[model samples]
Target: MHKKVLNRDRASFFVITLPALLLYSFFYIYSVVLGFYYSMTDWDGLSRKFNFVWLENYGKILKNKAFFNSVTVTFRYAILMVVFTIVIGVLLAVALNSVKRFKTFFKSVFFFPAMISSVAVALIWDQVFIRALPNLAPLFGVANIASPLGNKQLALYAVLFVNLWQSLAMPTVIFIAGMQSIPDELYESAVIDGASMFDQFRFVTLPYLVPTITVNAILTLKGGITSFDYAKALTGGGPARSTMLIGIKIYIDAFGDTPKFSIANTESVLLFLVIALLSIVQLTISSRSGVNKA
Candidate 1:
């Protein structure tokens, strides 16, 4: 009877999860396998008959100056986004959590940007930078206040600023939750021990939030790497490709006039590897920090 019930339970669980598992396998696993194969071939994404040229796509990426530039821009955007978001997120979270009045209102205000679609956010900022700023510049007696998307020197920074604005809410919410989850007694103890707020944060609050930081790091890494919609909607990889991130480069390679599907696949595979490596490195650091704290 026990064995029969156990088997029935297993069957029920599998039945419940079967649809999702099947979808995941079909969409994710099969697609990855297909992409990997395609990455080894010279498929033009149009011609049905394509030749398999192993490792050539990968080798080509190394020598491609445009691809190298895209990588540099991506890393620059990711680092700036991650650092600014962490600092601003923690500050906002701390303030919002500590406040007594209008806390709910402030939270909603800060998170409202996140509720907006990325495309919409980008468009809105695009208008501000391209239309409004230029017009307002003359009023302020400022010269050359044009769209950063059109200026090679300022395009990347413009994209970074807009992306940062759009990406803050989730991390702030997570930091707030982390702060709240910490026991009140810890803060009280620190207060009694004559520790100021900064000291308390360093010793009590910061230590407790390490796991949250790890999760946010991974989230930011993913966000930074695959950031396409905002960049596309805002800059469209313009001003001589100054703002062209690797994701944009992949899209252009895959879909542009000369659609190099295999090259796109190669870029995709490299991106996946990069993300995986960064994730592992973050996990290692987090684990080591946990051990040291223990």
Candidate 2:
């Protein structure tokens, strides 16, 4: 009787999960596995017959200067986005936590951008960078400051700034949520002990907020590195590929012409490895920090 009951439970579990599992396997896992196989073969994405090119595609990526530049751009965007988002988000969260009036209004105002479509956000920022800035330069006191997007020297940073502006709100909300979750007594106890505001923040607030910070940092880093829409819609990785992230480069390589499937697959593999390694490192660091804090 017990054996029959156990079998029934197992069957029920499988029946309930089967559809979602099938979808996941077909769409995600299957594609990933097929991609790895295709990475070894030099096939135009549609071709039925193509030569297997072993490690040549991977070698080309390793030797490609453009690939290195893309990697650099990815890291640059990720670092800037993570730093600015965390700093600004934490500051705003702290300020908002202390506010008494129009708190929800202010929170919604800051978070409004996050609710907008990324492509829409990118297009709006593109216009501001390409058209509005040029027209408004005189009002800002420097008529010589051209659209930063047009200048190769400033284009990538310009994209980074716009990305930061759109993204900071989510982190701010997360930080605020994390802050609110902290026990009120901790702050009260610190105040009673005559701890200065900064001291209380450093000792009491920061240690507790570290987990949220870790999660946000990892998310920002991954999103930055894999960023496609903003770079695509804003600059199209223009001014001699100055703003080209790895994601864009991979797209260009894959479908820009007769699809270089093997090369693109190699790039995809490399991109996945880079992101996976960084995520692992971040998790390790977060774990260590949590342990130390405890």
Candidate 3:
């Protein structure tokens, strides 16, 4: 009777999960396999027939200077985004957590930007950079200041600023949660030991938030690499391609006037590999840190 019931329970579980498993296989597994196959071909994205020039697409991408430049831009932006997001997020979270009154209201206010779509944020910021800031410049005795989006030297930073504005909400929330998760006894012990506020934060709070930092780092890094809407809606890789991130480069290669779908797919595969590798490294480091802390 027990054996029969176990078999029946296993069957029921499979029946319930089969649909989701099938969807995953179709959407994720099958699409990835198909994309990998396409990456080795010379398909122009519209042709019914194509030759598989195995690994040639990968070689071409390696030699392509534009692709390299995009990768460089992406890494630079991603590193900056990760660093700034952690720092500002922790600071903002600490501030919000310290608030005795209106704490919930403050968090909601800060998170409001994230509720808006990226394209909408970019559009609104685009207007601010192009018209509002430029128009208001003369009031400060400055005349004819060009928008950062139109300036090659400052365009990337401008885009980073806008992206960071919207990206902070979730990280801040995570940091706040991390702070809250720390036991009151820890803070009480520190107080009894005569530790200053800064000392308590450094020893008690920061040590506890290492895992939170790791989580935010991975998220921000991925978001920075995959960012497309802001670049598209705000500058469109404008001025002189100063803000031509890898995602935008892949997109253009895939759907430009001369579409190179194979190359685009190759880039996508490489990007996936990069993200996976980085995430693994992050997790490994985090695990080591946790072990050490324990």
Which candidate number has the best lDDT? 3
Q: What is the lDDT of residue 162 in candidate 1?
A: 88
What lDDT would candidate 2 get against the real structure? Answer: 0.87
Output the lDDT of residue 208, model 1: 84
Winner by TM-score between candidate 3 and candidate 2: 3
lDDT (CA) per prediction: 0.88, 0.87, 0.91
User: In model 3, which range of ten residues has the least summed lDDT?
Assistant: 285-294
lDDT tens digits, residues 150-242, model 3? 888899899999998987999999999999999999899999999999999998999899989998999999999888888888888776778
Candidate 2: lDDT of 174? 92
Off by over 4 Å in 3: 291-294
* Lowest lDDT block of 10, candidate 2: 285-294
Question: Per-prediction TM-score, please?
Answer: 0.95, 0.93, 0.96
How does residue 2 of candidate 1 score in lDDT? 100
The candidate, 1 or 2, that scores higher on TM-score is 1
The whole-model C-alpha lDDT of candidate 1 against the native structure comes to 0.88
